[model samples]
Target: MDLIRRLFTAALVAGVLSGTAASVVQQATTVPLILEAEKYEVVTPPPATAAPTTTAPAASHAEGHQHGPVREVGEGVPVTLDEAMQRIGLTIAANLIAGVAYALLLAAAILLAGRPVDARRGLVWGMGGFVAVSLAPSFGLAPELPGMAGAELELRQLWWLSAAAGAGVGIAALAFARNRLVIAVAILAAALPHLIGAPHPESAEGAVPAELAARFVTASLGSAALFWAILGSVCGWLMSGVVEPAESRPALRVQPGAR
Candidate 1:
C-alpha cells in the first residue's frame, strides 16, 4: 500500500509538470496551425429547398463552423481576449489529464520491469515511449490538421492503438531479450501494423496547404517528444527516492547505552 501510494504520488506530480509544458508547446505551435486550417475547412451547404429566406445560408454557414473540427470561435470573427484565455485554459486542463494517464502507464511499466529507474534512465525510457507511441504509428498515419482529409475517426484510432502496442512490445523485447530469434520477432511485431497499413480517405485532396500540414505534423511530434521526456525524468526522479531522501533513509541503529 505504501509503495502504491508513492508510485501514484510520483505519477501525479510528473504528469502535471509534463502536461503544463506540453500545453505551452501546443499553444505556441499546433494551436496557430489549427486555427489557420479551420479557415480552409470544407463545409457542405444546406440544400436550397431547405432555405426559406436568403439569410438562411448565412445562419447555416455559422452553424457549420460551430459543428466542425472542435473550433469554438466563429469563422472570420476576431477572437476576444477572454475567449482566447478560455481556450488556453481548456487546452492546459486536457493536457494535464492526458499527462497523468501517460505517467501512470509509464510508472506501471517501470515497476513491472523491475529495473532501477533514475533521471537519466528515465530519459531513455521517455524516448522509447516517443518511438512506440509517436514515431511508429506516424509512419502509417501522420498527424492531421483540422481541415485535412482522413479516414473515419474510429478506424484511425484503432490503427493507432495497434501500432503503439506493437511498438511497445517490440521495444521491450529488444531491450530485454538476448536471443537472436526473439530480436527478429520483435522487429516483425513492430513492422506488422505498418505492413497492414492505415486507413485513408479515398481522396487525398484537402483545403489546407501541404506545407502547413507538414509543419503541423512536425510540431505535434516534437511536442509529444517533449512531453514524454519530462514525464519520464520527473517520474523516475521521484520514484527513485531522490526527491524524498528522508523517506528513503534506512532506520537508525540503537547502540547499547553506557551506564
Candidate 2:
C-alpha cells in the first residue's frame, strides 16, 4: 500500500503539471488553427448525378468538420462564455487524463529497469516515448485538422495502436538487447507498420488549407514532445525520493570503537 501510494503520488503530480503545460501550449498553437479550419467546413455541393436522398455524403461532410467531440460553432457568431468555458474545460481534462496514464506507464518502466532515477534519465525516456507514440505513427498519419480528409476512424485507430506498440517494443529491445538476432528483430518490428501501410482516403480533398494542416501537425508533435518531457522529468525527480537505492543509503558510523 505504501509503495502504491508513493507511485500514485508521483504520477499525479507529474500528470497535473505536464497536462497543464500541454493545455496552455494547445491553446496557443492548435486551437486557433482548428477554429480557422472549422470556418471553411461548409459542405461542398454534391455531384449533379448524386441522389438527393442519400445521406452518406452529408454524413461524411459533417464528420470531416470535427476534429473530435467538440461541436461546430458557426462563422461570425459570437462564442458564448459557457461554450468557451466548456471547450477549455474539456481540453484541460483530456490532457490531464492522458498525462496521468502516461506517467503511470513510465513509472512502471522505470521500476522494472531498476535504475536510479533522475531528471536527465527521465527526459530521455520521455523523448523515447514521444518518438514511439507520436513521431513514428505520425509518419503515416499526420495530425488531422478540422475539414481535413482521413481514412476511416477504426482503421486508423488500429494502425496507430500497432505502430505505437511496435515502435515501443522495438526501441526497448534495441536499447537493451545484445544478441544480433534480437537486434534484427527489433528493427523489423519498428519497420513492419510502415511496410503494411496506413489506410488513406479515396480522395485527398479537404477544405482546410494545406499550410494550416501542416502547421497543426507540427504544433501537435511539438506539444506532445513537450508534455512527455515534462511528465518524465518530474516523475523521475519525485520517484528518486520514493525508492531508495542501496548505494544512496547513508553508511553507519562507529565512534572510535566506542561500541
TM-score each candidate.
Answer: 0.82, 0.82
Model 1 alpha-carbon miss at residue 233, Å: 0.7
> What does the lDDT come to for candidate 1?
0.87
lDDT of each: 0.87, 0.86
**Best candidate, lDDT:** 1
lDDT of 1 at 136: 90
Model 2: lowest-lDDT 10 consecutive positions: 68-77
Candidate 2 deviant stretches above 4 angstroms: 44-78, 241-259
- After TM-score superposition, the amount by which residue 199's alpha carbon in candidate 1 deviates from its true location, in angstroms, is 0.5
TM-score of decoy 1: 0.82
